[model samples]
Target: MDWDKLRIFHSVAEKGSLTHAGDVLHLSQSAVSRQIRALEESLSVTLFHRHARGLILTEQGELLFDATQQMVKRLEATAARIRDSEDGVFGELRVTTTTGFGTLWLAPRLANLYKNYPSLKIDLMLEERVLDLPMREADVAIRMKEPSQADLIRRRLMNIRMRLYASPEYLAEHGTPSTMDEFGNHRLICQQAGAAQVAAGAELVNQLMTHAVASTLTVNNYFGVLQGVLNHLGIGVLPDYIIEDFPHLQRVMPDLESGEVPVFLAYPEELRHSKRVAAFRDFVTDEIFAFRRSRQTE
Candidate 1:
């Protein structure tokens, strides 16, 4: 019930050592230990199991820790919203997206965002995992599929498809695969069949593999596959959006591509008014528009 004690308990549970938690809280080890003991006495429950290496949370402690973790995330979100109300767009914006979209598309265009709001700090989390926006695991997300969470503001950024491409030199040297049957003559670069990816992408790779490709190079993420393609390793199955940045790459069998994969930008509804979130959302929307315009002219 005591906020101070709960805070200390949360720190100790996170650090797994009273001393480590004390260092973080700027309290003496004895003080932290005393607080923990007092909290356990008040609750009449053992919160941690003490051992040689470190402390492990008991069942009751785990429940309490989960509640406190939620509290921490919510408090941080509130603090960020409050700070946004006071100043220019100047704070950390945690953005989550797939590694392929994050590295290949979003990260490259962020310089302009920095130019406009130089004080903004971007914490870009690049992974396939869909972070919980409502729980504040991340402030914003750009995902390959529509987010189903009900309490979020979602925007369909664009649609993308997996298409085959190869470096000009590679196509020149190895020759282009004019038909699906010719795929066997060149190496096939793609994400691993079972790796986390949009279903359309995997299906595209599966279709290619059915052609009995001569050799293959599989990477866990599209970034690595792009590298393999750029280095002239093979014809790669890549997102169509990426081809704009890599104009020299030649599309193989232009008509062949995976079904559409919708891209969405989403954030917790609470962040609708946060300047940091708004700035990031606008920046991405603008970039997508610019990308679309550039592609139309070409």
Candidate 2:
């Protein structure tokens, strides 16, 4: 399929009219229509149907629209990455990080990065959702789990440990569970990263040497989960770095320990050598580890 034709189809789909798409692309309506006609001929399927109101996509067109939208986005992003690679410190960065770190830690330091390099634009997308780098969902990503996808370069940003914590008041009221078996009696909070499959609990159990049951408050947001635990609502597992800031929450059964969670900085393997990417990657890796070790002292 012709890439240019796809671009024309994408514009028409967005604008709902060939004339409007032509205006957006700086082409004539005839040219836009020709591209669409050529595309339909090549695919041997009608992508759009003429309507009195404007253009309506056929069922196949809807599918084509979805795929084309992704294609255009990835192409634009890949181009931006290439353009940014030329200059050591300028251009846009679409970075993705989990909600907790993005809110408490990253959002603050991001200003400093912009201050130091004003030319570089930063789009900080924070969600429990892990963006797909291969699909150009993000230029850089910081995630707790290691990247299992092929053709991605990953770097360990920090080794993070998690512990069970609850507010003092809650512990007093509910009583702290001292052993793994006692966990069954307590209300637990769990964080589920957006519909993506995360590591199984059995892996965590093996790592932490504890058994975990189904949680009562199952939340997808990290900040909300942390707040619930801090408010003495329930016991939840959190990165040690997060709980370190709130002294009110005490570690429940410090001896019932979980192993360290590895935080990673990852991007597509093809783009790792880009100057802008390398700079941000190294900067974050240094800052996060330093932050982690500092919390160890407290």
TM-score for each model:
0.97, 0.74
Specify the highest-lDDT model's number: 1
Best by TM-score: 1
Clashing pairs in 1: none
Clashing pairs in 2: none
**lDDT values of the candidates?**
0.93, 0.77
Candidate 2's residue-wise lDDT over 100-152, tens digit each? 77775677677666766778878889876778888888888988789888889
Model 1, residue 230: what's the lDDT? 96
Q: Candidate 1: what lDDT? A: 0.93
Clashes of each: 0, 0
Taking all chains together, the TM-score of candidate 1 against the true structure is 0.97
Off by over 4 Å in 2: 1-6, 14-16, 26-31, 38-45, 52-78, 85-88, 169-187, 192-218, 295-298
